[model samples]
Target: MIRTVEVREARELLDHLLPLIASPWLYVVVFAIVAIDGFIPAMPSDPVVIGLAALSASGPPDVVMLAAVVITGGLAGDRVAYLLGRTAGHRVRNPKLVMAKQKAERALRRHGGGAILVGRFLPYGRTATAMTAGSAGLPPSRFTLHTTLAAVAWATYAIGLGRLGGETFARSPLLGAAFGIALGMVIGGAYTLVERRRAKTAAEEPEPELVASGRR
Candidate 1:
């Protein structure tokens, strides 16, 4: 009897929470979080988007709007970071920022297109890449194009994963959220590991004569 009561209470709480999660304002909130996250890596923008996307399964949330908002927010935030780096010039002294800049430069040097695309999935990777590109005086056209593509791809992946989780566990949104979070973490960890390995390998390898000649 106690277990039954507890289950009922939990369901009631979820029921109440679903409406808020599905509210139109939820898109606005998600936009704000994602935008802020670009400048501040500590923000939980990804998880929030995933959870709300799960809640959207049982509500009238507009998935298209959600995706659009997320993409817009991410791009906005990245732009801000880029501008800050551009304005800072060369006097940047923060050790952490310096490290981020180095990582960004290495990724850019080694991967080029892949760096901008894959960096979106890694923690702090996107910010580092954007800032580094700005500091390096990358052409505005090139930066805009790559960042836009990356943002769209990231939004699609995040929202699609959430929807899949929501559909799989429709009866319990909490379960769906948990599943989505777990799946995201797994994917992120695996991607990070692969990228690190690839970077290490690239570091150990020597450039071909033709590539060296092109640089000269």
Candidate 2:
């Protein structure tokens, strides 16, 4: 019941914001949402980007402008998360996160730029890759270059999905909204399942060091 209510409330909130996002200040709103959403993992910026693309279908702003806004918003949002990692990298010592630490460091060391480029396409990859890159002490210029390129590709893909919906439904905003929500739910659900599986596997695994040392 509570979960359903929260979903309903969230849907209502997104619906309420549609008109506001379509306003002349859309870019500013998107930029702010994207930036904050990255820092706070729960909030998603994809819906707003898709909304803007839908608005562009019947509206005044150019598609290019919408795309630019989405890209800028994403990059800005990622930077906030990246900066957080850069500053707080030392203090974060979670066993789960730490388990991935060596792999992340190895990725950067071996693959260098390509790993960061491809990692951006992943769900938690953007922030996680950025955080790992920071923790591994990758150069800022290299990190920014890869992140910027990845952001452009990601923004293009997201906005393109909305545009495809917009064009397919004869520029109908309703269709775009539907597509965005559906995609968000699917991706969100998949992410949840992956996390649960990872947790389960981690819980089931024996501690190699403890086993070897006969401590358990």
Candidate 3:
């Protein structure tokens, strides 16, 4: 009974909050949040996007537009990072970014295309991979192609999740947003853990050495 009452209250609260944020300005906000998050991983872009998507799922907002905005924003930010990396090269001074760059380079070397795709799902991984690819002098055409695909896939996954969650709790946008955000975080966290383990295992393996053959 208490659970039902709480859900009812939350739904009433969301009904009041939705109209204010569900305007044309919402798309602009989504774009800015996603683009900025690409450069600054600490930003709560995922939650913002998911929350907006949940709202859209429940009412007048266009989910497709939301997805498109996020994809464009993400790609634009990634391109900016890539250009910076290309221009700055190995002279990056920030220790944290430097480490991320190095890890991205190694992942690219070992995994090639897969690394770019997988990196999109992780918070810091996307920026690091794009920047590292640029710094490593990867061809612009190749990087664009790979990153575009990754962005599309990532955007679709996030938007779809929000839509599903919202539809499930159509009466309560708050519940929908919470569920969607939590699920996205869980998926991202699991992927990051797996990637880290794989990277560690790879690092521990020794490289094969070439042996020259001689006539006996």
Candidate 4:
């Protein structure tokens, strides 16, 4: 009963909020959401980008501008997170986050420029990479170079999915947006699942044996 009420209320709130955010300010709204989400993993910026891009098929905020805004927002937000990590990295206490941070640090060390690029698709991945990079003392030039590439690729991927929905449902804006958001969620979920499976497989592999000290 409570879950149903909450869902209904959330829908009502979304319906109420949509019109309020549906104009020239739409760009600003999406940009802010994506940027803030860079540091704080609270909002679903991917769906917003996908939905807006799908609506762009109906011809309002130009697709180019929307794409630029999302990419720039992602870059800006991640850079800020990186900056914050420089000061706050040592303060992490939660066991899970600590493990994640250590893993990200190792990835940064092993892969150098593109570690974060590959991981950005996973949930909370941007934060993990940026923060770990900053805390790990990774050079700003290298981090920025790769993160820029990652942001552009991420934006393109999200917008592409939206465009797919828009093209498929040319006459129905709502349907296009709904389809795009759903598709992004499905793909992101699948990617995360695959990564987890891979991680498990790698963990289960046995390490090579070392020679005994007297054998030589």
Candidate 5:
């Protein structure tokens, strides 16, 4: 995967980004990016947070503060996205998207905040789930509670990953940050592949026949 052009570009980008985040303004950058990521699925918040956290762990004593900032930003962004969904839900004219939103609504209604918590881990899952929740008229208090839980879990996991990379490459925090990002990509890719295989297998598998019941 590191041999791929995308990976190389990502490496270069993170390498460039890591240095910019080392200053006293690190907190602001982390918070802004994490918050922006909540509504913008393409924002790539994970890499930035991972990189900053790696540097923080290796060079500074502020990783704890970083986590707090990230969680706050994440919660803020999620709320904004939820509100956006509520306002824009009716404006969605695409049939496919509408159908998808309907399905999401059903799932959210049935499962409650668990769906929101789960979505926070999946790529682009948080934005979609949050928006759908708002659109579906899920209560604000419930959404906030679940979003808070998800933010904490996500922040802790991301920081831990960064810390692992930082500790592994203590001599070169930049390389460690890159490693963390790459590791995250590999994990996400593997999860996606496994899910696809599961879906395919389920689709292909035949249902059991009820011979004992004497179905005609």
Candidate 6:
């Protein structure tokens, strides 16, 4: 069933599921989005988190509970990435991405848990930091402790923005804006992926040669 799932349909299903989010179910959405975001770099969780915050105003879920679930979800999702980095961390040899990640790992070595704390504010850093910690052989307990704190701060800020949107603008307007922003990001990301692939292919090919005597 998962094999046949289309991205648009999956997103639409998520939209339908959004209104039903309340009580325990809210946690499910939080974890799902966070997990997907951590597992796949392309999936954006900020809008989903924000959208959930907006929904909370009308649903049975309260702010405190919403915040807690979001933090838990984000932490859970991040842990998976950390483990992946730990297990297969050495497999990724791309100098471009690796050099960036190495800087984060070096910081982890110097600052210990402090690196993860600072990494929370960064986009790519958040996931790479976790991997860096794991790869650096940090203890699980220490990783979890700092990661939990970071997750709470991250979720709070994201959800707060969503809540602010719901408060400042009407629900319909906020939802429309959020949807447009999400769609734009998706298109931009897809275009980037396609362009990168084209560039990579072009770089691998041989250049055309000039005619030998101009009389073939």
Give the CA lDDT, 0 to 100, for residue 33 in model 6: 70
lDDT of 3 by residue, 65-175 (tens): 888899999898788878877887477666766677777776776666456777777657777888777776777777788889988988888777778779889999768
Off by over 4 Å in 5: 1-22, 92-103, 200-216
**Arranged by TM-score, best first:** 4, 3, 1, 5, 2, 6
Question: RMSD to the native, candidate 3?
Answer: 8.4
Candidates' C-alpha lDDT:
0.71, 0.60, 0.70, 0.72, 0.72, 0.63
List model 6 lDDT by residue over 27-86, tens digit each. Answer: 776677776665454455665566666655555457677787678777877798789788
Order candidates by lDDT, high to low.
5, 4, 1, 3, 6, 2
CA deviation > 4 Å runs, candidate 1: 1-19, 89-97, 206-216
Cα lDDT tens digits, model 4, 3-60, are 1112333234335446744476767777887798777765567777776677778776
- Model 5, residue pairs in steric clash: none
TM-score of each: 0.80, 0.70, 0.81, 0.82, 0.79, 0.66
On TM-score, the leading prediction is 4
Off by more than 4 A, model 2: 1-13, 93-110, 180-216
The CA lDDT at 140 in model 6 is: 83
Off by over 4 Å in 3: 1-20, 93-96, 206-216
Better of 1 and 3 by lDDT: 1
Residue 114, model 6: Cα distance from true site in angstroms: 1.5
Clash total of candidate 2: 0
lDDT value, candidate 5, whole model: 0.72
lDDT of candidate 4 at residue 35, scale 0 to 100: 93
**Residue 122 accuracy (lDDT) in model 3:** 63
lDDT, residue 197, candidate 1: 92
**Candidate 3 TM-score, true structure as reference:** 0.81
